[model samples]
Target: MIEVKQLTKRYGGTTAVKDLTFTVDPGQVTGFLGPNGSGKSTTLRMILGLHEPTSGTVTVEGRPFRSRPRGLRHVGSLLDAQEVHGGRSAVAHLSALARSNRIPRRRVDEVLERVGLAEVAGRRIGGFSLGMKQRLGIAAALLGDAPVLLFDEPLNGLDPEGVKWVRDLFRGLAAEGRTVFVSSHLMSEMEHTADQLIVIGRGELIAAESLEEFSARGTRQSVMVGTPDTEILRDLLAAEGAAVRADGRLLTVTGLSAARVGEIALVHRVPLHHLSTRSGSLEEAFMELTADSVQYLAGEPR
Candidate 1:
């Protein structure tokens, strides 16, 4: 497991991460979420020892990463997959990493095949497409078969099939009892993939919990009713404290359940064509939760 306790980082007058505390347990996929300039990459860098925290601590298995001489054997990561040398072949890159970390050379070939890069193993990275480069980066991460993995925007340039493939690949890794932590800005993609979510904004932790519990926090369940007697039903439901809004022949009623709304319509002798409870979508709920935390605001048209 990875533990972050009151971790904070500063660059001159600007603070990137602030007093953040969280834990990433094994055998699950934890998604780190935030918008642009929300300090996600900064936090990831601190965790990987690429940046020093101004205060507090982050540890993997009860110690700082730099304390381990064979760090790659404990944690595998793909941060900025495109930050590789374009002059080197995929095999050469992995081989170099393996040699430095004392990993077997055959492990390079195994990881290349595992990430579907064996066919292009000898090809220079400059000739690889964005998706292929991403695959090669993942192959390098898996070369050591480490117990923990971290990926940042792993689906950035992949097609739909490639996106799904990577999603399932992370899920499978977590099922094998590995610690998988991925970061993404896309909530819809995360909704389909992550079992747990850690959401932050402007360097502050907004939420950290299971996806179900996070989604459940936005359950402002409302009933949508369509009837010819819209005006009458709207007034009746309003009088019953149902927070009713009328749009054409439809009444959007909140602060009440579907059954209560139906009973009110029946008792009031109103005809109903449609009555359905609208549960909040995760995206909708997320917008509501982080509406204030959005750092970049587009201006209205002139």
Candidate 2:
């Protein structure tokens, strides 16, 4: 598990993170979400001990990560896939990390194969595409077989297949009781992959809870109703203080529940063809919750 308590970081007069407290438990994938310039990268660096916190503390598996020898053996992180030496072969790069952490040289080959880079093990990283480089970085993270892994935008340059593979890989690792923390801007991917979420904005914690709970925080719940008497139902629903939008025989309703809509329709003897509730998606929830936290707002397109 990873624990952060009242963590804060400052650079000169600017505060990058403030009093952030959260725990990333094992046996599940936790997503780190925030808008641009929201201090996500800064927080990740602090967690890896790359940046010192002005105050508070961070620990992996009950102790400071910097206090542990062979850090990779405990926490594996991929902060930047492109940070590796471009001239080195994939195998050579993994080999160096393995040797530094006193890991077996053979483990390099295992991780390379696992990440689908064994075929290009001898190729120089400079010649690889962005996606290939991402794979190599993932290989290095797996080199130590660490129980706690942290990834920042691991899906940045991946194809659909690679993305799916990564999703499955994280799930597999969590099933084995490893702590998997992922930081990504892709809400759809997080919706499918993460079991929990840690949301921050402007260096402060917004939410730290299960994915379901966070999603449920969105207030844009609506009911979809299909009826032949679309105009009649629209007027009837409007009378109940519900906003209703009509498209032919279908009506989208807000400020009401599916059961209530059904009741209203039945009471008025309006036959209904279909009725279902539609909850807001993760992206919608994120946008709504982080609206004020966004640093750069674009104006309407011309």
- Candidate No. with top lDDT: 2
The local distance difference test score of each candidate is 0.89, 0.93
Residue-level lDDT of model 1, residues 6-82, one tens digit each, is: 99999999988899999999999999987777889998888888899999999987788888788789889999888
Candidate 2: segments with Cα more than 4 A from true spot: 229-232, 245-249, 267-269, 300-302
TM-score of each: 0.87, 0.93
- Clashing residue pairs, backbone N/CA/C < 3 A, model 2: none
The number of clashing residue pairs in each candidate reads 0, 0
Predicted candidate 2 versus true structure: per-residue lDDT over 1-302, tens digit per residue: 99999999999999989999999999999999999989999999998889999999999999988898899899998999999898999999998999999999999989988999889999999999989988888888888899999999999889999999999999999999999999999999999999999999999999999898888896589899999999999999999999999988999999999999999999999999899999878898899899888876779453
Residue 301 accuracy (lDDT) in model 1: 50
